[model samples]
Target: MNPVTAYRFITANQFAVVGASTDRSKYGNRVLRWYQAHELPVIPVNHKEATVESVPAIASIEEIDDPANAAISIITPPKVTLGVLKKAKELGIQKIWLQPGAEDKAVLDYAREAGLDIIAGGPCILVQGPSLLTHRANL
Candidate 1:
């Protein structure tokens, strides 16, 4: 999809980072920061109790208080991506952004089979998020 289409899909609703972490060095951690910088409502989904960029990181999607109209960023390993996708589907989440290295052909096929609108193997959230040159120009 084009950047505008992807941006629209992503910003249409609240979002959650499926593997977000508190570790400053991690991509998940940085992504959460980027989300917050954009003033987006983002929940961090991490099994650990550590908070990412001051946002509470929960263990699973089911733990989110309100998941309605939410999209998920799957930043976990390929081996665990399918499980996350299944959980997202179970929670009625239609949109997903699978970060690079977080998805494989099997995961993509499974997501398609499950009828999900997914953006996979694309640029990271940092590139496509509100920090874009387009977004900056509009500021």
Candidate 2:
């Protein structure tokens, strides 16, 4: 994961939490809560739910009002990650954060081939967020 890229991503005007869940026990829900706790503007994407944490959730990336420059944090399985990437590519969304356990070798390869700027593997957002938030404040 590239620290610079991650910073750029988190600092975007808007962010999307793909695969966000209502189940607080799940990482998907946890990720969504982190953004909310920080008072960030985030869209929750969940095909199965109309709302997550009381926020309206879009079922897919295609529903985003502004996808060309949007940043997204994915918390889905590898297969779903790939599909999200494909849609994101078509929408011109370039900044993607593949949360831990959300990616596999194939997902990584496809992101690369599609020219996505992704932060995958270790250092989940919860780890870097506090510092990153402070960094943003300082900036």
Candidate 3:
């Protein structure tokens, strides 16, 4: 899909950062920050109870109360992405932003097979996010 379409999908949803970490140095953390800065409702998904950037860090996708119109921003290891995708499917999430390095061809195929609408490997969230903001401002 085009960047505009992808941005619309993200901004219109209750977004979740699935691979969000407690570590400040990771891209997941940066994504969480970007979402927060944009005033997006972003749930940080991590195994740790510790909060990241002041957002409550959830341990799993199943824990989210409102999965309706939820989009998951995935930035986890490739090995773990399938499990996340599976959980997303189970929870009825449709949109997913699979960060670069978070998935391989197999994972991509799997996501497609699972019928998830995904945005992957084109631009990082930091770039797409700002571009989206600009697009909205111009409108």
Candidate 1, residue 106: lDDT? 89
Evaluation by TM-score, superior candidate among 1 and 3: 3
How many clashing residue pairs appear in each of the predictions shown? 0, 0, 0
- In the order shown, the candidates' Cα RMSDs to the true structure are 3.0, 1.3, 2.2
Candidate scoring better on TM-score of 1 and 2: 2
How well is each residue in 54-121 modelled by candidate 1, as lDDT tens digits? Answer: 77678888886656577788889988989998888888777688888899988999987998778887
Instruction: Identify the superior model by TM-score, candidate 2 or candidate 3.
Output: 2
Stretches > 4 Å off in candidate 1: 2-8, 131-139
Best by TM-score: 2
- Residues 1-139 of candidate 2 have per-residue lDDT tens digits of 6878878887777889998999999999999999999998889999999999999999998998888667899999999899999988889887788889999999989988888888898788888777778656755
**Per-residue lDDT of 1-139 in model 3, one digit per residue for the tens?**
4665486566555888888877789898888888898887889999876687877788998888777567788998888998898888888877788888899987898987987778886787787677566654543
Which stretches in model 2 have alpha-carbon errors above 4 Å? none
